[model samples]
Target: MTEPMTDLPCTARVPADVEAPDRILWGLTARQIAILAAAAAIAYLLWRAIGDRVPLAVTAAVLVPVAGAAAVLALGRRDGLPLDAWLLAAVRYRRRPRLAVPTEPVEPSGWGPVSERRPLPAVLRLPATAIDDDGSIAVPDTGSVALVVATTVNVDLRTGPEQAAIVGAYGRWLNSLTGPVQVVVSTQRVDLSSQATRIADAAHELPHPALADAALDYAAFLDELAEHRDPLGRTVTVACVAPAGARGEAVRRAEHTAASLTAVGCRSAVLDAATATAVVTAAVDPFAPTDASWPRTPPNDPVTAARSS
Candidate 1:
């Protein structure tokens, strides 16, 4: 090995203003400047509209709070949403009492910005034109893409040292891959009652009655738990997308991903056409039901019996 050279030429220098992360206005940051400027603009507009009829003192009194509130709502985030969003929530929250089997709203805000809540024509937001047979999403503007959605392995369940080891291994594994992969975690409200029912049913079909009874009791317990609990479920999915013309490449990449996941001691399933559609649907509307709910008639109901008969 060659000895370390003390005289290495330096080729790189830090760019100017790189340390200043955000825009500064006068002595304050941009957000502060925006708030002040917006409040002033609101006050000025209001003064021009009604200054002739109203006294200056009355105008100032009304304008101060209104302008301040507007500025804060527009510039600040509350509950991870702008304060203006709380206004639209009022309508949805009001309907809470009327819900039959209440499902949590997808968005915490359950609302839109107050200024944006004003009457305006609806806008088309979905860019996707179709979902291809190979689970590719087709967008007229952006073209086709095949995607993979996989489950997440829990790191918290492992011990501290194990977690560190896993992290190191995962880092290495990530380094091995050349393409882009996105990790997404969705917080959902899932209805697991049907799965529990199936589990209990399968258990009851076994030879031992005791085991069957125990399984049923456990399923009932789980059902109760779901009803009483927060209903929040976190699903982790890793996704990779390939272009429309490259379906084979997408599948190859997905297969490699599956093998990597298996090597890491994690279970993962790639989404099929239908499941991918549902996942996309849920992403767009998180409040969408995790499972289908079909109507069932009461055992003693006359109309149900009449139809069957």
Candidate 2:
């Protein structure tokens, strides 16, 4: 007998503006209200000062455009932030130093011409100050972060019940969050040269001549595809940050989060310090070689000074 479909416990229609700020008055946020109120106060003050000297029509003409601009700045959004915030960010970006260096900048000696003395290079400050031996990242004045790499599962291919189960599992993880957790999914260009080479090298080890020829053909095909097309790979990583003074807790949280996510059919593992360093380095510069040793040395920790004679 055919069974009727039942309601899914995990599925529901969520609004698009779930993260939108709460509307305090007349559908405007607190920030929007504050901006409008400030502009109104300024306009009122202008009117009080100019009422005797200036004509009302002329004053209105000058204030109308200013009022409209203030409304736009308060109500409009650009690049996911309010217009005022975006403008502030643009101003900050323009004011920041053009040149930056990894090493700390030293003040120039008082012996050179003012024009000849170049602007001191700005010290580059990375989000993470250091990578501990146990894989925790030291975030200056914030907390420690631990990275866990997880495999992705395709929910579209799953049946209705299976999809619901996966959703429920994911919901559990979301509900369990006490502190900040970031799930980063990134795609990068993949180089298939090494893979082709490995396959080609192992082609002769096959038992049958036909199998060996097939492997060789596959290797050649891979080389041709790689040359003709750009292949990309996706990686999913979860970064769990523990509060200040609880560095070790970050690692435990990462492992626990990995275990919790297993219900959704994702296989995950916590990255060790060396592997985490490599991952971070690769993210900063995708064109750089993966096995570079420079990333192993954390910022401000001079390798030369630590060397024993």
**TM per prediction:** 0.48, 0.81
Residues 88-190, candidate 1, lDDT per residue (tens digit)?
Answer: 5766676544423224333326454554542222334466766655555665654454455455667767666566665666666676665666778778877
lDDT per residue for candidate 2 within 1-309, as digits (tens), equals 899986554474546987788998999999999999999999898888887789989899878987999999998999989999999999999989989889998897778667665677899888888888888889987799999889999987877788888888888888888778999998876667667787999989989999999999999998898899987778888999999988599999998899988877999888878778877887898864242222365543556655678
Top-TM-score candidate index = 2
Angstrom error at residue 176, model 1: 4.1
| TM-score computed on alpha carbons, candidate 1 | 0.48
In model 2, what lDDT does residue 123 have? Answer: 90
Instruction: Sum up the clashes in candidate 1.
Output: 0
Each prediction's whole-model lDDT (CA): 0.63, 0.83
Worst 10 residues of 2 by lDDT: 288-297
Q: What's every prediction's RMSD, in angstroms?
A: 12.8, 5.2
What's the true lDDT of residue 59 in model 2? 92
